[model samples]
Target: MKLLTTNTLMVLLILISGYGYIASCTHDDIVPPAQANPTPVITRGENVHLPNATGVADGDTTKWKLDKAHSSVLWSTAYVGAAGLLTGRFNQFGMHDVTNAKMLKYPTPSRGQVLPDTSWAFYENDPSKIYFNGYVQMNTSNTGEPGRDSGCILGTGYYNTVKIIPGYQNLEINNLAKIKTTKVEFDPLSNDYIVTFDFIWQGSLASPLTQSIVGRLKYIPKAAVKDAVTGNVLYSVFGLQLNFQFDCRDFGVTSTSVADVIDIECNMNFNNK
Candidate 1:
């Protein structure tokens, strides 16, 4: 019952104010939990009927041109002792037809028009018909950091001299990494394709290394877009999702801080020409 001291009264008032502030906070004022990354959507071949190769010939000459705008080539590597991955991508690359001595090209659909249905043909059942020469521009390596990208091209620092392999140092060289498909086989169980190719890194310094990689090739014969009022198809879309890993040592990369294993994901889109 004794009168509270001035300091004690002030302390009590502070406590009451703190309690009132806490009581006034509602659910709306509380921060929500962080959200996990959303799963990517598969829009290339969503909900389309796959065509059968019943009448398709064994050596059909139909050509599917690559849609470079819709394609991507991403690479990642873990730091020697780090927990996360360092990812980057190539801004320039293309599929080539060595037999034709030219790069593959696709026709761009007009703003209001779409490619005809006959343009696209599926060759999954006949794997032999699926083949291409792939190339990557070494200078186009991008990691969102201009300095790091330049370092990657020069094979310096954490890149560990792996960016431009030996014998490819000539200024006149094309500065390209090439891939020539030697064989293609369809795996029914996984509904994917196993591709064996010569991954040519060094122009003449080393022999072509053979690597067998598996990739999912999704083909949608129908157009991805439709007319709002007429329901007419716009343009057909298809793509290959390829993920592979390789040791840097295999390509002469020997840095200790840089992980020996490098992962690559190439998402290639193609449109019927």
Candidate 2:
């Protein structure tokens, strides 16, 4: 009886070993339940490419210069005691310094492009690489009406308390530390950057109004121009258009008749000098 039990145990062991060898041989042919459909991981990073329609690379680190000739600041509010809207624009306003107005070309994948397969968080936590000091000369505002323009200028100054100071009436935007580079979206079709930054409205007697302004800065490529006589490339141009809206009450512009909300639009295109 003991001999018979021992033989039964050996037969069971041999069967188990044969099954293991068969499984190993057909490992590639069989699919496990867990691996039948695997989960996908998404990675984010700058996509570098050659100069395309925008004449810039995907991960281009080039610092673009702000073109002042093609730029302007426009704003509109409800007409004081009227039904129509009152729109005005600043004729003399630009990057605090064109020479130093630097922007990075961090291209992102969009328009049905494939996402990276690896994990990368470099841009997500990266600080702002660009700093610009933008200002609007309140005195250069034009609304077509001389009297109305003067009144609007006085009202704007009264709120900000800009005396003989020329550039004191300012619109400062410098917040490098707050920009989340990782989430910055790049539109490949039209070089537009969806960005958000701190906009410091230094006006009125109340205090400097600091608001996080979110908007898109579009880089419009213009037709290439060549020298008339030399037949050589004279210069190239691009347009930077910005549109945004905000509340006047937030900046202390409590005009008796003007509406609380204000609409702003701008266009700027210049050369790289």
lDDT of each: 0.54, 0.49
Q: What is residue 27's positional error in candidate 1, in angstroms?
A: 48
Pairs of colliding residues, candidate 1: none
lDDT of 2 at 212: 76
Candidate 2 lDDT over residue span 62-142, tens digit each: 223344445567788887778998877766554432121332111323421111111111122222332334545454567
Worst lDDT 10-window in candidate 1: 112-121
Displacement of residue 42 (Cα, Å) in model 2 is 20
Q: What would you estimate as the lDDT of candidate 1?
A: 0.54
Superposition error at 75 for model 1 (Å): 0.8
Cα lDDT tens digits for candidate 1, 14-107: 9999988887786549888899857533222223222223212223323345566678988888866789777788765655422223222223
The best candidate by lDDT is 1
- Candidate 2 Cα errors over 4 Å, as ranges: 1-67, 97-131, 153-156, 163-184, 187-191, 228-231
Give Cα distance to truth, residue 34, candidate 1, Å: 39
Predicted candidate 2: what Cα RMSD to the true structure?
A: 16.5
